[model samples]
Target chain A: MTIRKTASDYSRSHEPIVWGLFSAGGVIVAFFIPALILLTSLLVQVGIADEAVLSFDRVQSFAQAWWGKLFILAVIALSLYHTVHRIHHGLHDVHIHIPDSLAIIIFYGGATVLSCLVFVWLLAIGW
Target chain B: MSTSEKTIYRKPYVQNQSASWWLKNKFYIWYMVREGTAIFVFLYALILMLGLLRLAQGEAAWNAWVASLSNPAYIVFHGIALIAAMYHVHTFFKMFPKVIVIRFGNWKMPESYLIAGQWVGFVVCTAVILGIGLFVGV
Candidate 1:
């Protein structure tokens, strides 16, 4: 849509790194988020998991398991990355332009910090 | 004849743009809702992360966390978040095919195949997780 294409006018963006994370996170959420909300909320609210499932003892042991830790890490980190990326671009599409440096530091930077915290918390309780 | 020349420019009309510009169009509104789903999804994730953190801290912490979730307000919030997450998943599946086009030697693989395959994979994975927990006594 420009009068002429110029070499200096176009450049590849480094978006794919975050886009990949966003896409993976979306896939993960698509696969599980609704079910997660359902199982954790509705089922627990009902008779299911009242005494046994998700009980303190059960949940603690589940978290202590390696597979449980991996699942938690993947879900939390990816979902945060996905959500922040969406919010960042969502602002742009709405014509709310924040400075790029600040947006990056806040959104992606926050994700990095939280993801690290998840890893640490997972480790703190020991195997 | 030497004359003073005046430059005259016509002012162009500009469309009204506002922070709520998306409200002007149905499609834009829908798109905004899709993007906004992430907020609810993030809220759900944050609560879950807190639950995980408390679970890691030990039985006392996990019990307190579970007790907190029983609040009426938390239940209401989770209800809204659940609905939003469902919409997010629906939009995610629809848009996923555009992200990666599957191609065969000459003809392209149909988008339907990819979408269906994703659902199948989702089912299999979910089954594996649940089955192990049940069978292994975890």
Candidate 2:
């Protein structure tokens, strides 16, 4: 067996994994558009756009009936992961050598924190 | 040369097939497009949050926010965001069939069919939203 000696070989081997990340990211993002539109329409209807109502009371009522919040969460979380993965590879192309484990930790860690913050904020506001 | 005396030919050089730009750089391009969309989405979320905050404040605040959005700079930023969003949507729908697998007993659906269904769903939803917005003035 001949050992592969080039970047092309490395990429060819890893193409499927890269494509999987991209495709999954895409589907998640696609679903988000309609979900977002629905959420916006709800906000408009509830006088959230016309009145001073930041209390959790308003959001809980909204989310109770609208299942779009879950989709929003998924979109944000998946897109965050997708962002980090793509950026990591881009940095690699520029000869940056971040250890794989450290990179994954940082990326996913950031995503988790951000997602948690979103949930907490929404819940705190009663959504 | 006589058939028996013929020398076997061996090519002295093999052309390098790996240096072409697309072959060497397509991955990078894909990375850029994907990451760029992510960043755009992040920015879009921020804008959306701002709008939500303003809405939560009051109608005056919401109107002010909409008015601000009418500024040239905001329009440009929103335009860029819209373009980035469309790119993300188009690319994502193209890949939808592969990521999620739905099996119906003995029948399996193809990816293209799934993507087409998604687009149809999107168009229908958009139409409904637009109809509601126009009819209700919301």
Put down candidate 1 lDDT per residue, B1-138, tens digits, no spaces.
Answer: 579777768788998778888898999999999999999988888888888788777888888777777788888888898888878877777788887898768988788888788778777766765454433443
TM-scores of the candidates are 0.87, 0.57
Lowest lDDT block of 10, candidate 2 chain B: B129-138
lDDT digits (tens) for residues A3-120 of candidate 1: 9979998999989999899989988888877767765665566455443556776666667789888988898899999999998999888898899999989999999999999999
lDDT of 2 by residue, B7-85 (tens): 7798689774442333357875774675566666666555655554554555577667755654667656655665676
Interface Cα RMSD of candidate 1: 2.4
**Model 2, A7-54: lDDT tens per residue?**
765544545764565456655656554445333433344334442232
List RMSD in Å for every model shown: 2.8, 8.2
> Per-candidate DockQ versus the true complex?
0.57, 0.21
Position B20, candidate 2: lDDT: 33
Model 2 spans with C-alpha error above 4 angstroms: A1-25, A34-72, A93-96, B1-31, B49-68, B97-112, B128-137
User: Which number leads on TM-score?
Assistant: 1
Proportion of the native interface contacts kept in model 1: 0.59
